[model samples]
Target: MIGVSVIGAGFWARQMHLPALAQLPGVRITSVVATSPESAQRAAAPYDEAQALTDIAEAAADPDTHVLDIVAPPDVHLPAVEIAAAHGKHAICIKPLARDLDEADRMLEAVDEAGTRLFYAENVPFIPALQEARQLVDAGDIGTVFRVKACEGIGEPHSPWFFDPDRSGGGAILDMAVHSLEFCRFFAKAPITAVYAEAGTFVHHDRTTAEDTAVLTLRFANGVIGQCEDSWSLQGAMDSRFEVFGTEGRILVDNLHRQPLQVVNARAGWSYPMPIAGLVADGHLAMLGHFLDCLRSGAPSLSDGHVGRDVLAVVDAAYRSVASGRREEIKETTR
Candidate 1:
């Protein structure tokens, strides 16, 4: 069994990663690290066998821990990943890999130098509806995909830290838009060439540096066009939707939290309540299992450090496009 240690016991970690890890096979939660010892203890209570410690170094140094699952805040991702790499442990870190592409590159370099594998835990493409859409595209049901549109809207107001450009990495674009961008990249199976974006702080104007909403247009290398919208302040509740148009047909995925796929075509018109299997089994659990499989078999990671860096480059280009009021070219890197 692969021994696992979770870094950070925050809301996402508790609600998603911890519960999922509890059900995964061939994996054991050996320890947990948090900012506070009490919080770590509380987080580890469900897994009685796991130790709770405030010191990250202790968890990183443990000989029993074969993998480190980092679900910490964006800023702390690099440090934790570096530590895990230094100890020759495989790591799975939540996206966006780092605040910027430079940091992501450094993290990737460290992991490569240490001869350890790294996985970027992006759950969007792994979601049921999105996965179904990808399958359809691969099956030629959508024919030649030419255009795509996606949006992620969250109603809740973000904390002050989210408003700080440095801490949050330029507001909605990196915070929310990356999900849709990555989805488009995965489905289209093409590298993004350039981006043109517009951003504004329409809702939360009081914040010194933060955009409450953003819209981006992407040009893929294979002649595909894509658009993405992201917002922290929306009229209604959270909404995640995506649509892909191709020569033969089209696919649409809406209400990702509840429904999976909704499809419409020239022949069949529209189909409601399309059935699709959720990717990754139990979400975070599936990610953990995949990481363990990679560790044991020396298999290549699905979302490796190279892929993580590419996503960050897209994010960085989007922000640059927003600032310059012109299209920015995305730099390609080895994956």
Candidate 2:
């Protein structure tokens, strides 16, 4: 069994990671680390077998801990990842990866230099509906994907940390649009070459630097065009949806947090109600299980640090395009 230690026992940590780890086999929660003793205590309350600590170094140095799960805030991801790599432990880090591409590259470099495995905890692809959509596209149910569109927004916004650009990276682009970007990448099966974006603070006016809404258009390497609409402030309820158009047909998935896959074809019109089995109670568990499996089998991680770095590159380019009022090319990194 692989022993895991979790850092930053916050809402996501408690509600997602801890519970998911509890349900998985061949994994043990060896330690729970938080910014403070009280935070760690509160975060660890649900896991009776885990110990709460405030120092990541202490947790990483623990002999029993084979993996380090960093579910901390975006700002702390780099430091936590570095500490984990320093201690020679495999890591699973929640996304946007880092505040910027430079930090993301550094984190990946550290892990590579340590000869440690790194898994990026990106759940959007692992979601059953999205998975099915990918399968359909790959099967040529939609022949020659040419265009893609996706959106993710919440009617209600929470957490002051999310509103701060310095803390959360950017606004909707980094926070919500990343999911849509991943979806487009998954369905298109091509690298994004360029992006043009626009952003504004439609709501949450109190924040000065961060935006509340944004729209991005992407040019993929294979000549596919894609667009993503993301917002932290909208009319009603959380909404996430995607549609991919190809030469033969189209595939769409809507209300990703709650709904299933839907497909439409030129010959058949529409196929509704595609049955999907939920992957896991908590996505963190789904991702964690995969990480443990990789560690056990010496398999390569699906969402490796390089993938995280690539996503961060796209996000960075989007933000630059927003600022410069021109399309920006995504720069590929060797790391």
Give me candidate 2's TM-score against the actual structure. Answer: 0.90
Pairs of residues at least 3 apart in sequence or in different chains that clash in candidate 1:
none
- Local error of candidate 1 at 199, Å? 0.7
Candidate 1 residue lDDT tens string, 1-335: 78889998877778778777777777788898898989899999999699998876789899989888898778878988999999998888887788898889889898989988889988776665677778888889978999998898875344566677776666788888888888788877889999999998877777646777999999999999999999987744566788899999988887444544545556554334524323343245566667677778888877777877888888889888887999999987856
Q: Looking at candidate 1, what is the lDDT of residue 15?
A: 71
Write model 2 residue lDDT over 79-188, tens digit each, in one string: 98899999998888888789999899889889989999888888877766667778888888978899999988875345678777788877888988888898888877
Highest TM-score: give the candidate number.
2
Clashing pairs in 2: none
Residue ranges of candidate 2 with Cα displaced over 4 Å: 256-283
What overall lDDT, based on C-alpha atoms, would model 2 receive against the true structure? 0.82
Return the lDDT, model 2, position 197: 95
The alpha-carbon RMSD values of the candidates against the true structure, listed in the order shown, are 6.2, 6.4
lDDT of each: 0.80, 0.82
* Best-performing candidate as measured by lDDT: 2
